[model samples]
Target: MRPIWVWLKGPLPAVPWPHSESRPDVDLTPEHVVVVGASLAGLRAVEAARRLGFPGRLTLVGDEEHLPYDRPPLSKEYLGDLPGVAPMLATAEDLRELDVELLLGAPAEALDLTARSLLIGGESVAYDRLLIATGATPRRLPGSEGLSGVCTLRGLSDAIRIRAAFDAGARVVVIGAGFIGSELASSARARGLDVTIVEALTTPLVRAVGAGAGAALSALHERNGTELLCGVGVEGLEQQRGAVTGVRLADGRLLPADLVIVGIGVVPATGWLAGSGLELENGIVVDETLRATADVWAAGDVARWMSPDFETLLRLEHWTNAAEMGAHAMKNLLDPEAAEPYRHIPYFWSDWYGHRIQFAGVPTGEPEVVTGSWTSDEFAALYHDGDRVVGALTLDRRGDIMKYRAMIGRRTSRREALAFAASRRQPIVAAAG
Candidate 1:
């Protein structure tokens, strides 16, 4: 049986069929550039290809029928107060003016690395250049398919479902305390609904933003009447007649829920490229230049690029990171040898319960930490690797964080930073960095 979503396949106005796929007759010169994914990274990639003077066929392939739009609002503004904000790609009327074809809703069914062509919908689309901006999918518990009232928020439909559940005041149980989960909980609370957030980790956001930030976030959720179950693991989901009713913890606790939000985080949406010969550990592994392998590049939350300093692959789902990485990936796709390497002080911003929090740099493996607060709602917490500052987290006071982000551009000393924190205006310190 054909899926109900098959009607979702087609090309939009300027967003025509994604060219630059592995098709014959496409010039190797700057004549054809195909970009996959129509959302944040894919959209930006097309623009970058244009900027690189690629004066030829531009094709964009996306998995979603809806043109690219913002995801940050899904859990906050879109669900809480605002109603008319829908997902949309950037106003590329300029690209429309340039005759770039956009292929919407048809995902790459298979990737032929040897052929350098993607068999999208069983048709071989050739390309002089290709950009894989596939993006990420929500990480969910195993065996969750066909569970009614259970969903993960990563795309338009997910947001629509979760948002509908919130408006209905469904008894919501969210798994994971990561950024997405926290935002969902806070948004649900704002709508005056019963929401419970279940976290498997000890501290929320500590894995990504560190402990102090996590503690503050937990406190905020508690103060706002959201129940947070820490140190709890969801072993399995309970269903009554194929409909989700509750969540079962590994410790033998049954958490009843009319609706459950799983924010366990996201996995790179790279499953389509299984045999594409790309080095994919968890995602499409790319280099510093955002180049995956020969004639291939990836970006956004799906691309796991090697970190400059750290010996690890960093796949940040931050908004700023997505924009930065997408731009860089596009540049490389045009001219692999002439493109600049990708490196940005990773930053993420989230708003919840009237608090605007911003963070820069990856807060990982901190031995000792020093924090500074401000009279204004702006303050920065510094994460340290021994005596060197590696990461910083900020709250309401974003300007100070802006400055700190600039200061810690390459690296900084912990002692000097701590001095600034101690003698400064609003100082708040938590020794656990």
Candidate 2:
């Protein structure tokens, strides 16, 4: 596979990468801090701000009518008809205890950076400090709209709707083989429904995990009876009476489907910040301290902050990153004078067909050394940038992910990591024939 560093480059070349964690000494505690976006990141920011004893008016503004809810389960447990409870991030009592004023269903129409105010629900809400944790919106395939049974699994409502259709024995066709699509396929297979995943890449999760691990995941999915159509592009959606029936491939092939899930990916939810004059590329460009501007800060999927660890600007969309960044964003908002760079060892996990896949660090570059067999069900592959172990991917190997995560933090050498992984006592478990 080609290097991922190359792909991360060349996007918005004008914005320079932050090289140092230095900012002017400006100490002013605001009486009110408005956190836009009421999702996981937004909720965590408010919680952290309150926990840190920020004796200010904390307001959370959300576009969705429902309160902040967990999103990761939307593709897993919540995709089934077993228990359809909306997993909330913060309940009424929790919000009350935290003393957070929640303005749900009020989407910020515009951000007045100069005036330090947000236009929400036709009223200008001024803030001493502003946090843009608006997150991101899923990208939909062109012409996929106006068709029934077409869904994007980004919100709680979308999961419920898809679960109901799947329970009714609808043939599932997922448009992307990313984590969401793969997880949804696994969930659909659990319901004994016909599931097919179409991916443009040669292997599943090629971008996140390396080629070897991605191939292992692809094999696992196929073994579990999930048909994977990789290295193919979807041309259009076939509709019958305003309902999607199937997907037409670029190669002039049709795959029948009763319900179509578009998990292609997401774009940063920064469209509302347009004309506000904040640096906007793929996301709100932030400094190492997660500061978008002098007083404006962003977190979660909306803010692309320079990573001191990786020495690159990263906009991580995983749940863990969102939680960690949310907490750090609040801390920085309270004390931007500290200029503590948000340096973190990125980590995320996924479950597919009963196998737990965990990865840490930037899983880019080439996999030069392997601990166990890649073809095996349980093994760990170490990726390296030259001699430095840059990242790691583990399948069904619990507890070992942390070891590699720390190793990446320490910048362990390739030889040391390979020897350490090879010295593990667990015997290699072969893939079931």
Number of clashing pairs per prediction, in order: 20, 0
C-alpha lDDT score of every prediction, in listed order: 0.74, 0.83
For model 1, residues 40-128, the per-residue Cα lDDT tens digits are: 88777777666655566788887676656887887788887667467565645544644567666667887887777877766787876
With a 3 Å backbone cut-off (N, CA, C), the pairs that clash in candidate 2 are none
Candidate 2: worst 10 consecutive residues by lDDT? 1-10
TM-score per prediction, in order, is 0.86, 0.91
* Model 2 alpha-carbon miss at residue 285, Å: 0.9
